[model samples]
Target: MSETPTHTRVREQMNLSNAVYEAIDTPTASGEHAHKVILRDCLGTLAVALENSYKFGCASDATHSRMLGHFAQNGLTTNNITYAPYPEYRAYARNIRRTKPKLYSAPDAALAEVFAAYGDIARATWDTQGNPEPDSRHAVHVTALAAPYALREYPDLDASLVSSYSLVHDILEWHAGDTPTLNLSTQGHVEKETKEAEALELFCTTFSPEYPKLVTLVTDYEELVNDEAKYVKTFDKLDPGFTHFGNKGKAIKELGIDSPETFWREHHNTYVRMSRYALDFPRILEDRDTRAQMIEELAWPSAQ
Candidate 1:
């Protein structure tokens, strides 16, 4: 295994990160789709290493991230520069096999190892697309890291126009999710749902803009289900305070809509609305089962 100097390795990674940022984030970023895929892995490796270096205060430590904002505050300091890269990349690539089920070719693995070798990568918490978090600057970091990787593809900076324009699109989605709700009224509820729907659109559109037409079907289905949500009615009603514990059941005798069958019978119209959206987005119908499960959760008298 070859060992690159820690400083040289970091410089290389930083340069690659910058290239990747320009490739994926820049306005009118020019690149074939396949090029962006490899670039994402490049950014992921550097970002993971930087995050991990900050986490453990050294390249050799096997520790989870305790984000002290080391990169954010001091940037990459000298003490964090001792990276044993090729072997480090080997470890990261080998480890990927355990979690990533996709079959990787020998060349792909070699490419991943080389791509990952420029930094001291740390373990990353895998997250689902349903709830992307760290509501902070993750997207910025990812985009920033993408720049140097772009340079290999489009070397002439004077000739190529790369834009982090998607960063704005991503940030907009984050803003939408971060948009606060005043209350759980229909207005506030729709606003929140609409924002979530838009966020999904922005995220999915990174692959295809046509994605939204189908994705919206899921969003609209959710909105329709939310409309039938019992908690909506529960919010407006006055809480039956039991100042006197002597009377337990006497405080509230709200009509019970406990069973799924009962709920289906009572809210048949609402289910119809849900079905309509489901039928429209058949591609995602399997993903919308949360409503039936939620119905049971919201069946409590207090919830209703």
Candidate 2:
């Protein structure tokens, strides 16, 4: 079989990379306290996205073949080019299907399967009768789908970045436990508090020297919280009367915190810096301009 054309390979790799980053950047839940239902929804969304990427690859290959045919007709290449490597592309497509087999089996089947698994995990975790660990099968499926995309995009990325990203996915799955219960309480104070605390812990521990800029950005955020008299008010000014501290007002209300300051102190890392970090993954991977904008946003307060 002939190898895939260089252009096809490049496009496949680009799409895969974009998809992987999107998966990472998209939020999920963790632990016994997460909402299994929403977690299932998120997984379903990811599975569909992966499938779409496969279809996109197929279409891209067809387009490229037609273009190549035109080139040959015009005598661009004397050799008659045959596009036979379409099957090779299936390796990546197969992994996506394999990861979410039940979902891909039929229309809406995968979503139902994901929901069932999510329900099982959520019930088990919330009941407190047994360990409510995330569904291993679902976790495996997510990682398998994610790995190929990651490898294709940042082929040269340090193995550790890949590992770290996988771990991030795991954390999101675990957090899914909290999603179901998020809106149950009308006040939403407890949920917001819990998320803020969780986000803070995640932010501080996840940063490393390999991504020094990320670390620096987080550090600056910490400084803002620590010297809130100066920075908290400044952030508030950014959205006047909006209260930009401690998971912001909305997250604070969702997590159920009395004051943004309290939320900031307890979960400053995740709520402020880490949340932003997670959201930044796609921008950093897909668009240089977005990355620059992010860095500026993260560093703005500190620079002042």
Model 2: per-residue lDDT, tens digit, 79-120? 212112233323433333333222342215533453454445
Off by over 4 Å in 1: 1-72, 77-132, 157-163, 175-304
180-242, model 1: which lDDT tens digit per residue? 221134576678668767755654564234223323323333343432122111211101111
Give per-candidate clash totals: 26, 31
Stretches of candidate 2 above 4 Å error? 1-120, 123-134, 164-176, 180-275, 278-280, 283-304
Per-model TM values vs. the true structure:
0.21, 0.25
Report the Cα lDDT for candidate 2.
0.32
RMSD vs true structure, all candidates = 21.5, 18.3
Each model's lDDT: 0.29, 0.32
Candidate 1 overall Cα lDDT vs. reference? 0.29
